[model samples]
Every structure is written in C-alpha cells, then in structure tokens.
Target: MFFSVIIPTYNRLPILKKCLTALEHQSNHNSVENYEVILVDDGSTDGTLKWLQDHQLEFPHVRWFCQTHQGPAAARNLGVQQAEGDTIIFIDSDLVVTENFLKAHATALIQASKISDRVFTYGRVINTCNFEYPTAEPYKITDFSAAYFATGNVAIARHWLIEAGLFDTQFHLYGWEDLELGVRLKKLGLTLIKCPDAVGYHWHPPFALEQLPNLIEREIQRGRMGVLFYQKHPSLEVKLMIQMTILHQVLWGILSVGGRLNERTMAGVLQWLINQGKPQLALEIARIFLNWYNVRAVYAAYREL
Candidate 1:
C-alpha cells in the first residue's frame, strides 16, 4: 500500500528539513510505493514556506500546503484532505526517524490487514538524542493506555482515521487531543497496536527548576482539559486516580521536602487548588498537607504563592 507521511510544522524550518530528509530515505525503499510527504505549513512566520518551495524541485515526492495561523489540528486535517496514500503516518517536525520507521508502519498495516479490517499503529522512541528542545518527553509512555495512543509518532489507515473523524480542533492548544482521539477510537472498536521496532528521536525542551511558575500554569491548562475528559467518561477511573494522586504527592512534598524545590512544589499545588472552584476540595487538599506537617506554616506558604 502507498504511504503518506504528514508532518505539521510551524516556524521550525531547520527541524522540518531534517524530518523531510528522513522521509526522502523512506521513499527510496524498494517495497514502498506511490509514497508522498505532505508538509503542512501551519502559519509559520519563519521562511518555512519558502524552503518547502525551493525543495519542491529537489524532492518531487514532497507536497506543500499553507493555511492562515490555525493550529496543528487544522493543518493536519488539511493534509489528510490532500494525501493520496492509503495509509497515513504522522510525525512531528522536530524529530528524527529510524530507517525502518516508515517501513515498520507499512509492515504492520499489511500484516494487520491480512487478519483484520481495522489497523491502528504506534511507535516508541528508542532514544531521544535532543532533550534540550521544547519537544522533549515530559509524560511517561509506560503510563499510556494499551490502545497505545501517542501523537508524537504514529500511523493509521486513512479510511479508519476519516471514519473516526480527525482530531478535535476545539482543543486548540498543547493538550489532550491525542487522548481524545484514542477514547473515540476505542469506543468505535478499532484495533490499536504498538510497534516497538520503529523509533523516533525526539528533541524535548529543557525545563529549569526556576520555571515552576510557568510550568504550573501550563499544567493548570492541561489539568482543566483533563477534568473535562473525565467528566465525559466517568468510568475512566484512572483520570480521577491521577488527579487525587498528584494532590497526595504534593501534600507529601510539603512535609518531606526541605529545599526550595519542595517549597515550590507545595506552593504550586496550593495555587492550583485555589484556582479550582471547589473550596471544600481545596480545604481537603490543605488538610492532607496538614496531616504530616505544621498546618499553619504550610497554610501560610500555600496562600503566599
């Protein structure tokens, strides 16, 4: 089957160049056919569009499209519309690919198709070479569901994806959209498979300890989305467990942590609790903290941050 590797990028031309170069290697593979690289320029102010055009003459297999400053969700949907391949594989621009990455996906689909009608595949990162970048790993993959959903690097049957509907553009930012898709696909009874042989090298951003405030804000935004997700699927007990577990950990941090890091963690948790609408629940969180430490000191620091 033909393969379509869709990459959605914004203002990261250098990284995109490396990704496309990897795609070039994939196209040269003997078994792959009618393969094409769909590069969606998601309203980049950088010279991304110019570079794609210049490379158009060089890589005839590459196709380029542009949209006004819409997010990656919209850009990917556009790429799906234009893709000619039967199987669609998506990889983030700020990544490197193994030689067999695309081949492994194609292999999985062909093998799955022989036994079943539906095929959804995902890959893992063998080693992340560039951890100092923003795209570096934050969440633990081992914690991911058996459906093995991760947008960092994955492939799916084009027909199956269209049937499941594209990503929820409503998310509009860095959070939960992939989980949203995984939940939807599971509800539809699709087969999700993980391929360990195929790997992607990710370049994640290096976060400093002093950046706790900004990180807390980002988590707050993501946490809000997580609440919405749990609200929709009350049976997903893991979601509730994670929320309560984080609260529990922060409480432990207040008593056990001695340095600035522990203090920051406790402060951040309290800030998160205050923004939450449930005052009673916030009080409970505070009570949990008090269970191990001086309630008055913890309460004062909680309010200070």
Candidate 2:
C-alpha cells in the first residue's frame, strides 16, 4: 500500500459516518486502491464503537481501534503506529473527502522532491462545506508551499513523521500541534508543499449561537499558544503583532460588555499590555474590558447548558 488514512474522532458518530461514506467513494476511484483507512476512536461516549462494529463494508481498507480518552494527538499517534503504509494521511472525522483528494496528496508527496530538493512532503486543508460558508473551487497542487500549510488535513511520510517525533502529545486540545510539527519539519530543511488539490467538506453542522463560549475558550488558548510560538521564534515584530491582536480582542470585549472587566481576562490583557511596553495604558483598558469577556464567556456557557 502507498498510503494509510488516519482519522481520530471523539463523540461524533454521525459526522464520522459522513466522512467514511466519502472515503468509501474515494476508494472506489481508480487512484485509491492502494490505500487503507484507519479510524481510531478516541474514547467516544457516543455509539460510534457499536456502529463501526456493525459496518464492515470495505471500499478502501477499513480498520478500527479503541483507546482511552487521551486526546486527538495520542489518538493520531496510535493510528500512525498501526499504519502499514509508507505514507500516512491524517483527516478529521468531520471532513468528507473529494474524489481526487487522496490522489492529490499522494501525488504531491511523490513529486515534491522533483520541484525542490528541499521539499520532503506536504499537506493541505481546503474548505468544502457549502451550507453557510462559501465553498472553495478546485485548488492547484502548487498551493501547498512552505509559507502556507494547514494541518487539519495533511499527508506526510510515515517514517519521516516518526523521525520528527510525531505530534507533541502535550497539546491535548485542537490547536498548535500542527504548527509545532511544521516548524520542526522546516527546521530540518524539509519544505511542506500545500497541496490545494486535496479538498474535503466539513461535516459539522453550521455554527450555532449557543456554542460561542467554547469558541472563546479555544481562542484564549490559541492566544496563549501564540505566546509559545513567539517564545520559539522570538521576533520583535511577531511579538508586537500578537500582543496587539490580543489587546484588540480585549478592547472589543470591553466595548461589548459595557465596561466591566473579568478577572481572568483582565490578567491576560494587563500581561499582554506589559509585554508591549505600555503597561499603564493596558492596565487601564483591562480594568474596564476584562469583565466583558468574562460575562460573554459566562452567558455563552449558560446558553450551552
């Protein structure tokens, strides 16, 4: 086999079904015969395990494994460990692949070295969901350059991934692990080609007003992880940009909240301002707007409940 597709999913059985259906369709195509699908259940509480057990209709090769709730990184690593192919393609359970998606990724990895000796492998993430967000047109192969690469849907050499140490298991959430891996691969003189030809539709339902809190929490964590990226790169321009962005978010929160600052957000705002060399100004802003995000997050959580 030339490739193995690994999908790590948690409590999203219906979405997984959609993704598998797409994968099965892809497998029927001539280019996908040499691939296998490895679906790793990340300790889903939903009846995903039962469904997988009942469905054995093989289109592309299908296999399932269950593990304790160790987060997506561990689940992916487990999938990589079980893969028998030279290359492993990682896709989310909530993504439906296009007919040419697998072929494009495989072709890019195979031909990447010819384009540039520095290019080792590549991956791409394309938005294909057509409901609310605008769907993107077919992308060319050259889109997967080193400057722009998305991790959510990526294909890489299996052994090279092992050599790169796979994903950082410390990232127990949904972000940063991809960037960390990309940075390391770049450091090793490997160029990540963004194969825009690989496209997939997001299977999750349209965004709901009720789930805003989780989004806010994820953004806060994203900001914190941005700090980690700054620490690694340590560029003054980059630092200023991140700090300013966070400050802007805080300012917006304050404006929305009628001037009450949340304690946690206030700390983030103040800390961010201090780093930007305007502590007093940042303090004044935080004193007012921090409560706004707090209230927003609170209301968002209540709505979810």
Candidate 3:
C-alpha cells in the first residue's frame, strides 16, 4: 500500500524535526510499496518551512505545503488534496515513531482489508516530556486512550476520508475536528482495528506552572469546538464527549468545588508537585480545573447558539 502520511504542524519545529527524521527512517516492508510524508505548515512563525527547505535533502520523502495560520483541520484537508497515495496516515508533527512504524500500519491494514475495506488502523501513542530521548520513555497508564479516531496516530484509506467529506473547516479551534470526522466515518460503517505495534512517542514540554494559562485557553477552545461538533451530529454520544450533559456539569463542578479550585487557587499545590519532579502528576491534578473551564465554556457556547 502506498501511504501518504499527513502531518499538520504549527510552531513545533523542534519536535517536528525529530518526527520527520523518524518517518524517513522507516523499515522496508513488502506490504508497503512506498510512502510519502506530507508536512502542512499552519503558518508557523518559527521558520518551519524555511528550515525544511534548507534541509530538503535530509528528508527526501517529505513534501510540504503552507497555509496562513489556519487550524489543523484545514491544513489536513490541504494535505489530503495533495496526497497521491491510496492510504492516508494521520499523525501530529510532535509524534516520533519507531523504524517499523509504517510497516506495522501497512501490515495490519493490508490484513484488515482482506476482511473488509471498511477498517482503519489505530496505533498506540505514548506521551512523554523527554525531548532528548523521547522513544526511551516507557508506556504509562496515563498514556492510554479510548478514542476511536484521534488524529495522533491513525491510518485509513484515502477514499474513505473523501467519502466522509474530510474534516469540517468550521472547527477552527483546538479540538473535536478529528473525532467529528470519525462520527461521519462511523455512519459510513467504518471499523477501527487496533495496531499496537505501530507506536509513536508523543512529545511535549514538561508541565510547568507558567504553561497553565495556555493550557487553560486550549481547554476553552476545545469546549467551543465541542459545541460545533454537537451541532452537526447532535447525538447523545456527542453530548457525552463534549461534557455538555448535566452529569458532566455536576461532576466537574463538585471536583473543582464549583470552579473555586481554579488555577489561581491551586497554583501553589501545582508548583509544589512540579518542584517534586512530578510534572505529569501535577498536570493531571490541574485537569480538575482545566476540565471545569471546558465544561463551563461548552455550556456558554451552547447557550449562545
């Protein structure tokens, strides 16, 4: 199977370098005829396009396109339009994979296609903060995901995406774009096949107190996008996914003390956890307030509509 790996990147040049380098070094597989990496730069101010152009020879498998700071949904649509391969692999620019990454996906996909073409391969993503040795990090329980169609590490036939109408451009915010497409794909009777051998180490900076503002803002954006997702599908599943139900409101409200235990109120405790070399733990704890912000924002957006 010829695969087009669609990666949407922003100002994440440092990890994007590692991500592209890993893709270029994938092991040969008979099931995989060839593969190309399509890097769509979402108008990054970090000179991502220039750096790629300068080191073009280093990543011969890579072809890049640029947009004017559009969100990932639009960038991915552009990549799919430029893709020539029959299969499309969607991954973020921060995810660095092992040498057999494509081979694993190709092998699994080819096997699944025999059973039915209505199948997509979902890979494992291990989150890590170790930039220097990202792949060295072992899998953690917190890294486990139950998402049906997260764009972090997934592969499907290109035609299926076209059939589903690609991603909605209205999801110009932070989240729900991929899963919204998944909803459409589900209606098309697509089955998700787990491909755990295809592993990708998702790298991000270690949690810090200073990053809370940006993280909080991201949750808010996710909440707004959640409303857009619900508007399209308007299903019970979408309501649960977006945390728009009364149960979500009560759960987060009680956990966060009705928004009383916010970033400002919990800053000292979060910093203490960070100081104790447990940034991941700190981030999990901070999610209490972060999710509160998201739930509140979701209701606010729904009310506005």
Candidate 4:
C-alpha cells in the first residue's frame, strides 16, 4: 500500500531535520508500494520552509506546504487534501522513526485489513531528550501510552479519515484535536491495532526551570482545548479526559496542596531534582502543579461556555 506520512511542524526545525532524515532512509519492503512525506509547516518563523527548499534534493520523498500558523488540525487537513496515497500516517515533526517504520505499519495495516477495513495501526513512541542520539534511547515504562488514536505515531486508511470528517479545526490549541477525531473514528466502528515494530523516538529538550513557563502555558492551552473537546463529545469519558470532573479537582488540589505547592513553591525541589540528573523525575513532580493549572483552566473555560 502507498503511504502518505503527514507531519505538521511548528518551530521545531532542529528535530524536524532528524525526523525527515530518518523518513528518507526507510528500508525497502514489499508491504509498501511507495510513500511520500508531507511536511506541513505551521508558519514557523525559524526558516523551516527555506531549509527544506534548499535541501529539497536530500529529502526527495518530502513535499511541503505552508499555512499561517493555523495549528496542527488545519495543517493535517491540508496535508490529507494534498495527499495522493490511499493510506495516511500521522506523526509529529519531532519524532524520528527507524528504517523499518513504514514497512512495519504497512505490514500491520495489510494484515488487519484482511480481517476488517475499519482498522488503524498505532505505533510505539519513546520519548527522549538526547538530541545527539535520540534513537539510541531505550524504551522506558514512562513511554507506554494507552491513547486510542494519538497523532504522534499512527497510520490509517485515507478514506476513513475523510469519512470521520478529519480533525476539528476548532481545536486550534495545544491538544485534544487528535483524540477528538479518535472519538469520531470510534463512532465509525474503527478498531485500533497496536504495531510495536513501527517505533518512533519522540525527541524533546530536557526539562528545566527555564522551560516551565512555556510548559505551563501549554497545559493551560490543553485545558482550554479539552473544553472544546468536551463540547464536541460531551461524554463522561471526555469529561474525565479533560479533568472537568470534581474528582480531578480534588485530586490535583490535594496533590498540589490546594495550589499552594505551585511552580514557585516547588521550584527548589524541582531544581534539586534537575541538579541530581533526574530531569524526568523533576518534570513528573512538576506535573502536580501543571495538572492543577490544567484543571483550573478547564473549569474556567467550561464556565465561560
């Protein structure tokens, strides 16, 4: 089957380079007839478009489009509209995959299709901060995800996405656009088949105090978008996912000591963790306040509605 790898990128040029390079070197396999990398630039100011243009020959399979910072939902819709492949693979620009990634997805998809066409393949995503050697990072327990349909690394039939109405452009924020689309796909009786062989190393800068502001802002945006998700689905599951329920409120409240143990109050402990060479642990600890911020933002947005 032919595959169209649709990647929506913002200001992640460094890792985007590695992501594209890895896609460029996919192993030749019988499962895939051919593939194209559709890199959608979400109006990045960091010269992503120009860099791609200059190195066009290096990534021969890559075709790129640009939009006016419309967010990943819109960017992906544009990619799907332009894609010629029957199958669509969605991945973030920061994820670098192995050489057998496409073959693994194609193999899994072909096998699943024999049973039912209403199936999609979800690949593995291992998060790492080692920019110099992202692929070398081993899979950790924290890398495990239970998401039904996250765009981080997933492949599906192009027709199914069109049938599911693609992503909701109303979610023009940091999160939930994918899971919202997943809810629609579920309504269409789509089944998710896990494809562990198709691995992608998700790269991000190591957690630090300096990144707290942006991280916190992302959680706030995610909360706002979560409200939008609930507006679309409005199920108990959606409510729980967005942390709109009182359980979430009390849980995060108690963990964060009723918002008293915030980024400021926990700065010393987080910094100490970071200094101990445990940035991941520090980030996990910081999630107490981060999730509290998200819960508060979710309620605030719901109230506004």
Q: What is each predicted model's overall lDDT from 0 to 1? A: 0.66, 0.64, 0.95, 0.95
Provide the lDDT at 47 for model 1: 92
Tens-digit per-residue lDDT, 87-159, candidate 1: 8888888877767877887777677878886667888753333533422434355334443466778888788
For residues 37-115, write the lDDT of model 3, one tens digit per residue: 9999999999898899899999999999999988999999999999999999999999999999999999899899898
Show where candidate 4 strays beyond 4 Å. none
RMSD in angstroms between candidate 1 and the native structure over all alpha carbons: 9.5
**How many pairs of residues collide in each model?**
6, 8, 0, 0
Off by over 4 Å in 3: none
lDDT digits (tens) for residues 1-305 of candidate 4? 99999999999999999999999999999889999999999999998988998999999999999999999999999999999999999999999999999999999998998999999999999999999999999999999999999999999999999989999999888999999999999999999999999999999999999999998999999999999999888899999888899899999999999999998999999999999999999999999999999999999999999
Which pairs clash inside model 1?
A: 133-204, 133-205, 134-205, 135-204, 136-204, 136-205
lDDT (tens digit, per residue) of candidate 2 on 223-301 = 5555555555666654443343456545666574654434444556556656776644554454344334433433343
Q: lDDT, candidate 1, residue 278? A: 46
TM-score of each predicted structure versus truth: 0.72, 0.70, 0.99, 0.99
